[model samples]
Every structure is written in C-alpha cells, then in structure tokens.
Target: MALMITDECINCDVCEPECPNHAISMGEEYYQIEPSKCTECVGHFDEPQCAMLCPVACIPVNPAHVETRETLMQKYVRLTQTAA
Candidate 1:
C-alpha cells in the first residue's frame, strides 16, 4: 500500500526529500503522498524513506489505496518506463 500523511503532521518538511518516488508533497497544512506515485519503496528501497526520516511520524500506510507487491511493481514500471 501507499503511504499517507495524517492531520497529526507538523508540516516539518522532513518527509519530502526522503521520498525516492517524489510522491510526497507539501499540502495545504500537511504532507501528502500521491497514491498513483507511491510504491512504498517497493522498487526503490528496502524501507519507506518518508517513515524513516519523518520527525513527527505522521506518515502511515494509505489503506484506502492498498496494493500488493505486484501492483506496486507495475506502478513502478510505469513510473520509470521511459526508454534509456
């Protein structure tokens, strides 16, 4: 599943850069993870970068957009599908 930012977020700007997929962005008053872009680090890292660097620990799994490894992989494939 993708990650999400809750209202508990302090808007500390700690999670933005940690996202390898560039899925996290500064929302109106919190950080938001784009479901279409997030893979929970499936194709990038062993763990979710936002959670690792988040100071407030406001980032959590996006249950509304739950997806399996194969689905996440497919998302990753489309995200970086451009020819080299």
Candidate 2:
C-alpha cells in the first residue's frame, strides 16, 4: 500500500529526502505523500524509507489507497520505467 504523512508530522524534513520515489513533499501544512508516486519503496528497498527514517513516526499506510505487495511492485516497475 501507498504511505501517507499524517498531521502528526513534525516537518523535520527528514522523510522527504529519504523517499526514493520522491513521493514526499512539503504540503500547505506539512509533508504529504503522493499516492500515485508512492510505491512504499517496493522497488528500491525492503521497507519504506520515509517511514523508517521519520523521527516522529508520522508516516503510515494510506487506507484509501490500500494495495497488495504485488500491486505495489507493479507500480514501482511502472514508475521506474517512466523515469527511465
């Protein structure tokens, strides 16, 4: 599943750089995760880098964008292909 940044985000600015997909960005109030670009690091890492590096643990799976691991891997492949 894609991940999301909650209101609990402290805006520490750590997660943004950690995201391999560049899905995290500064929102009007805090950091936000773009579901379209979020593959939860399925293609780049074993775990979500943003959530792993976030100090406040504000990143979590997006319930609205729930997806299986295989689906996430597919998204990751698509994203990488597009970038290439």
Could you tell me every candidate's TM-score relative to the true structure? Answer: 0.90, 0.97
TM for candidate 1 is 0.90
Local accuracy of candidate 2 as per-residue lDDT tens digits, 5-78: 99999999999888899998999999999999999999899989998998889898999999999999999999
In candidate 2, which residue pairs clash?
none
List clash counts for every candidate, in order: 0, 0
Error of 1 at 39 (Å): 0.5
Best by lDDT: 2
Q: Estimate the overall C-alpha local distance difference test score of candidate 1.
A: 0.86
lDDT of each: 0.86, 0.93
lDDT of 1 at 24: 88
Ten contiguous residues with the weakest lDDT in model 1: 75-84
Per-residue accuracy of model 1 over 1-84 as CA lDDT, tens digit each: 988999999888878887878898888887789998998998898889888888878788888999999999998888888522
